[model samples]
Every structure is written in C-alpha cells, then in structure tokens.
Target: MKKVFCIGELLIDFVAEKQGSDLSKATYFTKKAGGAPANVACAIAKLGGRSVFIGSVGDDPFGTFLLDVLRENRVDVSLAQRTETFTTLAFVSLAENGERDFVFSRGADKELQYNSAIKSEFAGNLIHLGAATALLGGKLEEAYGHYFFDGLTKKSFISFDPNYRADLWKNKQQNFAKKCMTFVEKADLCKFSLEEAQLLSGKEDVAEACRFLHEVGTNIIAVTLGASGTLISTREFQETVPSIKVKAVDTTGAGDAFIGCLLQQIAALTNTDSLAGDRDLLVSMVAKANKAGAITTTNYGAIESLPDQEQLSA
Candidate 1:
C-alpha cells in the first residue's frame, strides 16, 4: 500500500454550537484537534490506510495532546516536530446550516520550520499540501519547497487543498494569492471550497474558476459547494457530486474528512492508475467522501465525529 504524507499545520480548535453562523451569542466551546493536513491524516487512518503527518508544533501540553490525537487515529507522527513555542489555536462557531466562523491564533504554528525529515517522503505515493501557513516565505518554505518540488518528478500523486485562512494573509492579498496559485499549479488533485476557489483564482464563476485552474496545470480540481455537494472537474471531464440528507450539528473538519476518505480510496488502487483516470470512478469516490464529510457534521468537533470504515461502508 502507498503511504499518504500530509504536510501542514497541527493545532487545536475550540468549537461552539450556536443558532446560526454568528458567534456573538455562542453557548459553549469544545476543544479538539484540527489543521487541514492533520485532519486528512486522521481521515485516511480511520479507513485503515497508512498515513503520515509532517509539521511542527509547540512543545506544550496542547502540542502533546495534538501528537497523541494523531497517534490515536493511527497516523504516523515520527516526522512531526515539536518546539518550545506555544501551540496554534482556533475558536470556531458553528451555525445551524453547518457554516462556521473562526478566530485563529497561530502563535507557535507560525514558527514551525520544515527540516530534513521528508526528502524521501515523496516515495509515499501521495503528498497533500493543505496548510495556509506553509508557504509563508520563510526557511520552512525553502525546506518544503525542496521536497515538494522533488516530488514533482517522483512517482507520487500530489494533492493540494488551499485551506486558506483569511487571517493568515491579513493584508498581503497579492502575496498570498501568488503563493497558493503556484502550489495549485503543482498538484495532481486539487481540492478547494467555493470561496477558496474564487479567492485563489480571482474568478467568482465556477466554470471559469475550474477552467482557469485547469489551465494552470491542475488536472483534477475538486471544488466543494457546501451542501450542494462538490464540483469535480478535470482537464477533460467534469462531475458534480451530490450529498445525502443529514442533520448536521457541527461542520468542523468536514472538508478534511472528505479528502481523507478520498485518499483512502485512491490508496486501494493496485495499479499505477492516475487519480484522474476515470471520471465515473472519481465521482463515486467523491460521493463516498461527501458522506464521510456529512457524517462528521452530525456530531461535534472534528476527529471526534469522523466516521469509521463501518459507517462509511454501510
């Protein structure tokens, strides 16, 4: 089986359930592990897949808890690093329609540095770039750039999720847009929410956004349309995945679960089949992944609500 390497931030999220997307009058907050890459790693592991997470965290109680959380989900954290800084944290407020608002603090996660751990990780067959803080033009950029670029020529299925954090960019809109676009151009499978797709591509229209992304070399684009399902577009094909009815309680980590389940399915392919080989197969996989995402929303927190193989296969 191919190993899945997820490179990005590892942090804690405090989620609050409320009547609507507004967080002004939230009742209570529940803390849980989060970060797009970490969520994907957990999702893949839940499906009995070999998954690894590569990133840095503060050597604090929160960091330790995050490490334990990853290991508990059967994700490999040997490549994960820890520092003496404070761990990153986010407060999320969920609405009745599954929308969420967040207040993020990247104290230590901003200081996370990439090192010599993943020069050989490209052989893992899949590498997912899903963190907003990753391409912040630091020493970590050079480190991640080396390995990510190296993966370009290797036998790896490169996946990308522009898990854009508006707060991370702040006022550097031009710089952030450039950085994400460059990463998108490198991925074999690209995942984005409608907002991210529009923001990254600067095109509000879905068809145009997909076309623009494809022209930039992203062969497979998965644009998540919230409750409307997903738009799976390839250079040669297009697919719109629909979701099943579910009572969503919290939307935290739903997108990551979708990607995680999608990767788990791809890892089962015995041959050297590319991810964009068949449109029908990709649609089916996305449908299953959609269910995985929807299932997570029925409960609180992220990993705490992720569906296991039994739930998904049922």
Candidate 2:
C-alpha cells in the first residue's frame, strides 16, 4: 500500500461526559489522544493502511501520551518534532446523544513549521491537510507549499479536509476564506463537514457548495452529514449514501475516521488516482467510509475507539 502522509496538529483532548452540555454546573474532564490529523493517522493504521504524521509537539507529558498513542497504533512518527513549548490541549464536552462541543487551548501545535524533510517525503504519498494547526501562519503555511503544491504535486495525490472550527479563526487573518479556497483547489479528493462546506463555498445548499468546489478545481468532494449519511460528488456523478445505524456514544473523531477509512481504500487501490471515471467504485468507497464513521460514534475517544479491519470486514 502507498503511504498516506498526514500533516497538522497532534494534541491532548480533555473530554467530559455529562448529563447536559452545561459544563459550568457539571464536572470532570477525561484526557485522551485527540486532534483531527492525529486521529486520522491512527484510524489509517488501525485499518491496516500505512500513515506517517508530521508536526510538532511540546516536551511535556501530554506530548508523550500523544506520541505513545500514535506509536501504539503503528503510525510512523520519525518526522514529528519536539520542542520545549507546552502541548496543545482541547476540552471536549459531549452530550447524552453524542453531540459535542470543544474548548481548545492552543499550544505547541501552533508552532509546527516548514522543513526540507516534508519535500523529501512527499513523493508517491497521499497528503492530507487539516488538523486545526495547518491554518496557522508563519513558516507552516510556506511548508504546505514545499510539500503539497510545489515539491510533490507531480508524484502524489492530494486530499484535504478543511475541518473548519469557528472558534479558532476569530482572532486570525482577514482572508481566512480565501486561504481555504486556495487549498481546496489543489486537492484531488476533499471532505468537509456540512458546516465547513458552507463556510468555504458561501453556499448553503450542500450540492451547490460541492459544485462550486468542483468548479473551482477540487476533483472529488465528500460532505459529511452526521448520521443522515455522506454526500459524495465527483465531476461525473453525485450520490448520498445512507449510514448504517449504530448505538451512539462519542461523536469525536468520527469525521476524521471517515476520511482515514476513505484514504485507506484509496491508497491501497491501484486505480485510486483515476477516481473520476470509476463512479461505481467511488460510490462503494464512500459507502464503506460512511460505515467506518458511523461506527466511530459507537465508541469513545478518537484513537481508542477507531474500528479495526476485522470489525470492518465482519
């Protein structure tokens, strides 16, 4: 199988299961290995796919835990960097029905920057961007180019997940929408939550939003809709795949797992790059991905609850 190169943040998530969303009245936060890209890498590894993660973490207990989780799941961490900065932390609030809200305390994840190694590793790999940290500026934005746009464009296929979080962009740049569209245009396959697709395309209709994205240059667009299922569209055909119902638990990392599962099949398949003409194959891939995502809600934590190949095959 070809390797999937995941770029972005790795953080420690502090989760709390409460009777209600009112964290002010209730109590307790459970620490877990979180962060979207990190969870995606773990999901890939657990499904018997190869994934390598590149990012920076602090020299702290949280970082140690994050690294241990990734290594335990069989992810290659050679490109991960360590510094003295404090590790990033997210406080997750989950409701009884499995819906979630987050309070993030950005730390070392913001410090991940460009390096020559990203270019060297880009060839023949499927690159995934988005994990809360990739949108940060400074050397990191430049690094995105060295790897995705410039260095490896000719050799590898690109996949993107905007994973937009409204909370993080409040104090940032004036051109946030512009930056997102720029990256969307470069991806071969891209997935976004319905909320993210609207935010990026400025179109409320999911299909219209996806159409705009494709017109702008994204080849394959998949928009996730919680339990209702996923909307998959290529330049050829579009379909909505209904999700397999499951007992709900934690909503965290479900979308990331969906992306991971999709990439797992793509990287393992020889015709992955030619997804446009293979409508039937594409539909099946998205349907399988939808199942992987729905199953994630049946468990807790991102990495801890990811379904393995045996469970998936069964």
Candidate 3:
C-alpha cells in the first residue's frame, strides 16, 4: 500500500471528564492527544495502514506526549517538528449526547513552515490536507498550499477534509467558504460534514450540495450525515452508504476515523485511477469506513478510540 501522508496540527485536548454541554460547569478535565490530522494518521496506523504525520508541536511535555502516542501507534513521525512555542490546547466540554463545546489556545501548531524539499517525498503516495487551522494563515497555510502542489507534481493522490472549526472562523464564514473550495477543487476526494456541505455549497439539500462540489472539480465527494450515514458522489455514481449502528459515546473522532479508513482502502489499490471510476469498490470501502467511524464513537478520545485491524475485521 502507498503511504498516506497526513499534514496538519498536533495538539492536546483538555476534555471535561464530566459529560455535560456547559464548559463553565466543568470542574475537571483530562488531557489527550487530539488534532484532526494527527487523529487521522493514528486511525490509519491502527487499521494496519502505513501513514506519515507531518506537522509541528511545542517542545513541551504535551508535544512530547502527542508524538509518543503517534509513535506508539506506528505512525511515522520523523517529519514532525518541535518548536519553542507552547503546544496548542483545546478545552472541550461534552454534552450528554456527545456534542462538544470548545475553547482554544492556539500556539505551535501554527508554526509549521513549508519546505520545498518535502516535494520529493510524496511520489505516488497519498497526501491528506486535513487541518482545521491550516487555512487560518501563517506558515502552516503556506505549507498547505505547497504540499497540495507537491502532491500534484509527484503523481500522488490527494484527499482533503476542511475539518471545519466554527470556533476559529466565528464571523468569517464567507472567507472560510471561499478558501475551502480552493482545496475542494484540487482534491481527488473531498469529505465534508453536513454543516460544512451546506455552508460551502449554499445548498441545504445534500445531493445539491454534493453536485455543486463535484461540478467545482473534486472527482469524489462524501457528505457525512451523522447517524444516517455518509452520502457519496462521483461523476459516475452517487449513493448513501448507511453507517453501522452503535451507541455513540463521544463523537470527537468519528469523521476523522471515517475518512482515514477510506483513505487506507484507497491506498491499497495499485492503480489509484480506480478511485474515481470504481463504484462498487468505493461503495464497499465507504461502508467499511462508516463502521470504523461508528465504532470510534463508542469510546472517548480520538487516537485511543480508533478501531484496530482486528476490531475492524471482527
């Protein structure tokens, strides 16, 4: 299988141990390694896929622990960098129904500087632009663009998930919509949550939103519909693959798990071109990925909750 390269933030999440929606009422919290791209990298590795994580974290205990978690799961983190700044931290409060409220202290995650030399590292592999903060500017945003072109030039398959964080773009929805599509237009596969789909395409209907996204340029578009499952679209096929039913506990990593598993499956195909053309294969793959997502929610924390190959097979 071709290695999947996940580029983006690596941070710590301080989750309220008491499950309730209000962040103010929370009395205590627990720290966990949490970041969308890092979660996806760990998810892929846990599922027996080769993955590489490229990003930066502070040269602090939190950063060290985050890297340790990734390494423990077998994700290649040689490209991960350590910075002098503090590691980014997110305080999360979970409602009884698994919804989350967050407050962020952004730091080292934004310091990822783009390196042209990394272009040679992605040949015929997969590059996933799965960062919520990458589009927010600074060196990380620059790296996001460079990696996109690097993937193009290296004959690598590109996947993108806006991983939209509403907290980060509070009053900048329009700007978020505009910048995200630039990536949507370049990706081979684009993943979106229902809210993200509606926001970006200006279409409330999932099908219409997917159509708008497809027309823009992405070869395959997937709109996640929470418990209803995922709606997948391509020029040749479109269908909703139902999710595996489970009693979800924490929904934090579900989307990341879904996309990570799907990317892993895509990496296994010798001819990457089949991803855009194979309907039955893609459907089967998404169905499996849906299960991965469902299973993830049955536990708490992103990396720790992701299902392993054994769990997935069973």
Best by TM-score: 3
**Between the candidate structures 2 and 3, which one is better when assessed by TM-score?**
3
Question: Could you tell which candidate, 1 or 3, scores higher by lDDT?
Answer: 3
Give stretches of model 2 more than 4 Å off.
171-174
Leading candidate by lDDT: 3
Off by over 4 Å in 3: none
lDDT of 3 at 129: 88
Question: Candidate 2, TM-score vs. the true structure?
Answer: 0.95
CA shift at 70, candidate 3, in angstroms? 0.4
* lDDT score, candidate 2, position 234: 88
Q: Candidate 3: how many backbone clashes?
A: 0
- For candidate 3, give the lDDT of residue 80: 92
Which pairs of residues collide in candidate 3? none
lDDT tens digits, residues 115-212, model 1? 65466667748888885677776655665676578677676888888787776778987787788777788788889989888887889898789999
Cα lDDT, model 1, residue 282: 93
TM-score for model 3?
Answer: 0.98
Number of clashes found in candidate 1? 0
Better of 1 and 3 by TM-score: 3
Sorting all predicted structures by TM-score, with the top scorer first, yields 3, 2, 1
